[model samples]
Target: MVSEERRVTLREVARVAGVSVSAVSYALRGAANIPAETAARVRAVADKLGYRPNARVGELMAHIRQARPLAKAEPLALVYLEGDRATAKKNGFAQIVEASARLHAAHRGYRLDAFWLSEVEGNARRLAGILTARGISGVLFAPTVGEKRIELDWPWADFAVAVAGMSELSVALPRAGHHHYEAMREVLRRMSAKGARRPAAMIEATTNERAHRGWQAAWLAYGPAGAARRLWLYRAGEKNELAAWLQRLKPDALVTDNANLIHAAQAAGWAEPNERGAVLSWHARSAFGGIDQGYDDIAAHAVDLVVTQLQRNERGLPDPPPMLLFPGRWRECSQTSAGGHAPSLREAMRCAL
Candidate 1:
């Protein structure tokens, strides 16, 4: 009698195809993120090796996974790109985002690990090695703090990476952040509705550039006629120039993202926050409310971006890297989140890109 033939395993197929087991599985399932060429190659190799699917084993494993408690969670890294870990801990915004990311990672069956690029001597390559050694496959980069460009030559192909902010990094990776354009527009609209005709936008030059000039573009598109001309791209030591420009424009409302704008306006003898239409683009840590950026949501979304890629076994920089932005909620006179619903990420990207 002929003996029962040995069954081929996914590991054998992956070893022969020179791909990962997860990749082989995704390729078999025809996951959208899995490249078609790679999927075809995996299929050809599996066919040659006579690898047959074990439906009974697959179902049993699936059931076991569903019933098992999440005791051994996968490790994920959340790298804060600010100063040192000490500085990050001191930063209120950084602390808030970090806590949110950690909480969301726990909910997603991942144990979030914290790392500071500054603590690692700003050596991104070393950081990469450290993360890989710890068996971390997914990474979430905290949104960079300032307008300065972050130069990182990290080996990005080895893991799934996502960012919590805009295009400040040297390499363009998938990112999620506040929608500067829509937030600016919303602030201006709310101010206009509150009886401010001559509204001028005050922003920093590099800040606007980092925002893709969305602030200026929104001023032109949504504000009163020639409001773009009324914009004051304030820089350091330009308080005198700013005062003169304010005198010339005589704007009824100062819609600004910079906190310093309020102080400058005070020096220029502008009205108080309550008296004039002075509003903020980011409303956190301010009684002078304008837009609630929902930072907790943004941080959670960043984790989602990485987790999605990890589930699909996708690595490397994506083609036409996606930018998911959220339009902030308008907090008007009531000290509550007024109804200002942001569009979906895809819908927002249409206006943003």
Candidate 2:
């Protein structure tokens, strides 16, 4: 009868081949330093002995390689399409997102480089050449303000790309952004809990379009039983119709993206949050209570997503681009009394009257 044998091992193969363990390892991994004849002989020995590589060991080795700090990697491009510096600054969220992405990329042993679309004179081919020359294989498209659509004529098939917001570019790419619809829902819920009978939404048409109409959709969905939900649209440099809408709807609480809505309501002879509740959907300052969009988190995730594409060798627009949304945090900006307790809206209303 044939004798039973255990699995072949690399150590036994090395011993039989009269080579050091390191030599055996290098030879097996096809290191160039090993003599071709020696490598071939060792491989033959391994094959004869049925010395198969251990999957778990391979996985651990891969993990070790990844854990080792890389000296350098190709820089990632943060493409900004805003027309000018002032426009970029005015879109405060874009600045925050770019800063967050830069920090996160550094943590991953990579550099983030900013590329302003305006600098390239709106030439996509020139942008592509610049990126190629810099060896940048990954891109993070920053959120674009206004109604301008980004049309890139670059060789997109060669680079991994992702967008911070859906409105950033016309091309379909993986996106990371705040959960606008859910945030609207959350605001409505909080208002309801505060005994607000009627809640309405007023959004700038451009802002609404940029957010993919999420605010309007959420408001329409949250209409209470037997109540007609109202959504007011505001166009830039257009006549102010919000006052008329307020007079007609008489909504107890109003949710809006524009902070100026408070002034508009006041001009309409209604005290904000005191006579009628007001919630700023996009809160840029601590003085106004609204949803914190968590821009930093969104930007970090966007970097990660783009890096993942680079690692996987994925390029161009994704078929059915995936969207990642982060939830917004609610902030209460109600006025506080000397005792540090928030004054009731009713109390403020009485004071205003």
Candidate 3:
């Protein structure tokens, strides 16, 4: 306890850098108003002086920012595929999740500015140039509807990046997405517990592969005995198999992401009105209930991951890239009805066992 070193202050760094405290501030944050070269030099000097930002002050600023106008927020990059449906489909899951990310980022004093890959013709070099010119340090890769892998040669070392949504990225970095495996297992378990003796999971092959076979694996691990044959993995336009499969299983319950297939079975007199079934995705929800895989929450976490990286001055692909997964929320039939009020995805299951 003989001696204690004093923490470096912004005032001290500013004085040594031959600039005002405001310049120092902008430079440290890599704010676009300041030149990139100036920002780089200032950061280097701060590093040499052993400067550290106070977390409490940052937390307070973030709280204050909550009350600020959208125009005042700093800009962050939102990278998405060109023509990748923001509207996505009739359900609009892609649109809703992206909008949530924008709102949450705004709450943190950051504005998510969209940049489609089409802008630069999928050229990562040109994309990086645009981002650098704008002084954007944080980047979020938006979700895709059907695309699984990205094919860009991006320079990850210069930016704090995170990807979000239902698809997986080819380039590894931090990501936030739905916990597909846990969700599938939970749904199957609930179906079994709710008096489903011969429940079957009818999933499409592409959807199953995209989720890394989480749906298939869950059915295999926990489905009813001899139910594997009942688990028909079909493709689009081959849904007619439902009638034959239904005849074979005569299942009293079902676990599926296909509302169209369910409707076909019901209309064909295979599925009874009282038959119980769990819809796998909210996007696929019909009059029957389903799981709401918190897309908004996943989007928020992606933005948060990018913000945290920027705060720590961390860039490049993280080692073993971290992934944050959120589980699904069960929705009841009432919530799926016309003019029905849907609750927040963050809430726990409100129906089934």
Using lDDT as the measure, the top candidate is 1
Model 3 pairs in collision: none
Which candidate do you rate higher for lDDT, 1 or 2? 1
Give the better candidate number (2 or 3) by lDDT.
Answer: 3
Compose the digit string of candidate 2's lDDT tens values, residues 1-353: 11125656778989999998889889987899999999999989877776755433433444465663221125889987666556766776767887899977754445799888788888877887898888787888887667557666777777778888656565778989878788888888887887778767777888877787777777778755533347767687653676777888777777777656765675787544642344544333533456777777788889888876665455777888888997667766554454665556553333221
- Superposed Cα RMSD, model 2: 15.3
In the range 182-204, model 1's lDDT, one tens digit per residue, is 88888887887778888787888
Order of the predicted models by TM-score, top scorer first? 3, 1, 2
Q: What local lDDT score does residue 34 receive in model 3, on the 0 to 100 scale?
A: 95
- Model 3 local distance difference test score: 0.72
**What lDDT does candidate 3 reach at residue 157?**
83
| lDDT of each candidate versus the true structure | 0.73, 0.70, 0.72
Error of 1 at 80 (Å): 2.2
- Cα lDDT tens digits for candidate 3, 137-164: 6889877666356667788887889988
Q: CA RMSD for every model?
A: 13.4, 15.3, 13.1
Q: Least accurate stretch of 10 residues (summed lDDT) in model 1?
A: 344-353
Each model's total of backbone clashes: 0, 0, 0
